[model samples]
Target: MVSDKNSEYKFTGGNSLTGIHKLYHEVMMLNELWNGYGAYEVSYAAGKSGISFGGNQMDMHDNKKTAEKFTNILISATDNAGKHFFTQGEVKMIVGNEFVNLIQNGEVVLSMLGDNLASINAALSSVYGRARIDQLYVSEIKNGAEHIEKVIEKITNAAAKKFYDSDLGRVLLFDYHNQYDLKFDGRFLADYINGKGKENFSTKEMVVAPRDHSKYRAIC
Candidate 1:
C-alpha cells in the first residue's frame, strides 16, 4: 500500500524508476556515491565487507556470510547454473571453504576430476562459461522489507499502514535496512521520526539519514 501523495523531494542522478523501484534504485545510487565506487569497479575498502564488489558493493570476503550471499544470488540469478561451480554435490567439499580462502588471498586456479564442482580459475572461466544477467544488478531490498515491516508495525503502528505507504517511508526503510542492528526492535526509524519532531512527515529532508543520531543515538 504505497502512498499516492507527492512531495517536492528530488532524486539524485535522476533515474527513471517509479513506485517502489524508484525509491529502491535511488538508495542504491546513494550507496555507490557514499562508497566512491562505480557500477563495475571493485574496491578493497573494509566497511561492512573486506571486498566490495559490483554495483551493489557486495561482500566478497572469504567467510560463511559471503558464501551464503553469493550462493543465494547465483541461484536466484540463473537456475543454479552459475553457483554449481561451488555448490554441486560431493565436490562442494573442494570448493566450499577453500574457494573463499583462495579468493581472499589472490587469484583462484584449480582443475579437478570426477568432481561435480566446476573448474575455477582467475577469471572464473569454466565449462559452464559466463553468467547471464537477468537484471542490471542483484539485490534483496524487497526481502529485507520482511524484517523491516515487523519493526515498523510494532514500533510505528498506524505509520506502517499509513505513513509507510509513501515513497519517503519506503526509502527510509531501505536506508535503515543497511544500518539496522539485529539486537534492536527497529525502533531507530520511529525514534528518528520523533527526534525530528515529525508527528506527520512533511519534507524529503526528514527522510535523509541524520548527520548525528542526536537524542536517539542512545536508543540504538
Candidate 2:
C-alpha cells in the first residue's frame, strides 16, 4: 500500500510537469505567429503610403506641364504675328556710279529707311487699307488692347480653375501644412480658383531689389 501511494505521487508530478511544458510551447508558437503578422501589416502600410504619395506628385507634375504647354501655345501665336508685322518692311538703299568706280575710285552711300515711322504707317495702311491711319491707331489702342486683355484673362482663369480642381490641389490646400513655408489657409486654393487670389508676391525681390542695375540687368 505504501509503494502504491509513492508511485501515484511520482506519476502525478510528472503529468503536471508535462502539462506546463505544453503550455509554454503553445505560448511561444502564438507569439511567433503574432510577430509574423505584425511584420506583414507594417510592410503593407508602408507600401500603400508610398504609392499614394508618389501618385499625387505625378498628377501634380502632369497638371503643371499641361498648363505650361497651353500658355506657350497662346504666347507663341500672338508674339509671332506681332513680330512679323513690326519688322516686315525693313529695307536698305545703296548708291554708286559704276561697279568698278564704286569698288575702288568713287564713294557710295548706303541708306536704310523702311523701319521709320512713315514706312510703318504706310505698311499699316496697306494691310488695313479700308480704314484711315488715325482711326486704326485709335481702334488698336482701345479695341485691340481690350481684345488682347480678354485673351489673357481667359487663359489665366482657365489655368487657375484646372489647377484647383485637381487632386493635388485638394491635398495641398487641405492635407499638407507647409507649402514652401507659406501659411496657406484652406481657403487659398478656393480664392485662387475664384479669381480672388493675391498678386503682390515677388519672385525675385530679394535677389534683385538692392543690386546694381548694370550688374543685375536682365539679358533678355
Candidate 3:
C-alpha cells in the first residue's frame, strides 16, 4: 500500500512493527507526505548562475512508466540469446555435408539407411571408394517418409551448385551410389547464371580443414 515516492518507507522501520493496524497507520502517513511533496529534486549553481530544479525529472519519470509497458514485447522479439533455427532444406544440407566431411576426415565409423546396413555401406563405398564410412540404421519405419522428403529437398536445392571450382565449397551427397554430389565450386557457377563470371572467378575451398595440424604441431 506504499505510495510511489514513499516506496522507500517500508524498508526503514516497518520491520519492527508487529501489528497490522500499526503498519496501516504508517502507510497512510507515508502516502500523505508523498502527495504533499509533489516530487523530489536537486539543484546545482555554477559561479553566479541561478540554480534550477525539477527541469525534466517529471518527463523522465513518465518515460520510464511508458517504457515498462512495452518491456515484455521488447523482450519477446529479441530473445535469441541461445537458440538456432534452420529451415528444413538448410538442415538437410548441413547434415549431409557434415556427414561427408566426417567421412573425408576419417571421423565416421558407420553409416546406414533403415535396416539396410550392408546396402548403404556398399553404396557409400562405391561412391567414395575405400573410405571409412559410418552406418546409422533407422529402426523406426514411420520416419522413412519424412526422411526421404527432407533428403529430396536438400538434393534439389543442392544440385544448383555443381559446375564451379572444386575448392569452392563442400558438396552435398544424396545418392552416394549414383554419385550425386552438389558442388559449389566458386562464385563462377552463380556468376555464370547471373552473367558475372567473366569479371571474376570465385575463390573457395572444397575440403574441410585441409591443412595438416599434425605437421604444424611437430614444428612447434
Best by lDDT: 1
Show model 2 residue runs off by greater than 4 Å. Answer: 1-110, 114-131, 155-220
Please, what is the whole-model Cα lDDT of each candidate in the order they appear? 0.39, 0.24, 0.24
Compared with the true structure, what per-residue lDDT tens digits does model 1 show for residues 1-220?
A: 0112111222122243455765666676666434322332223443333433333444455555544543433333322344443444433453355455324522221222223222322112222212211132333444555555665554433433355545666566666564343223333554443243333255534342234434233333
Predict model 2's lDDT versus the native. Answer: 0.24
Q: How well is each residue in 1-220 modelled by candidate 2, as lDDT tens digits?
A: 0101111111111112233233322332232223212110100112112100010111111233322321222222222235432321122111112211112211111112222433322332232321222232233223322332333233334544344333333223222221121132323332333344444356522221212333222321
After TM-score superposition, the amount by which residue 119's alpha carbon in candidate 2 deviates from its true location, in angstroms, is: 11
Please give the clash total of every predicted structure, in order: 1, 0, 11
Q: Per-residue lDDT tens digits of candidate 3, residues 85-186?
A: 334453334334333311221112122122332322222223121111111111111122233233333322222322211111111121221111223342
What TM-score does candidate 2 reach? 0.16
Worst 10 residues of 3 by lDDT: 132-141
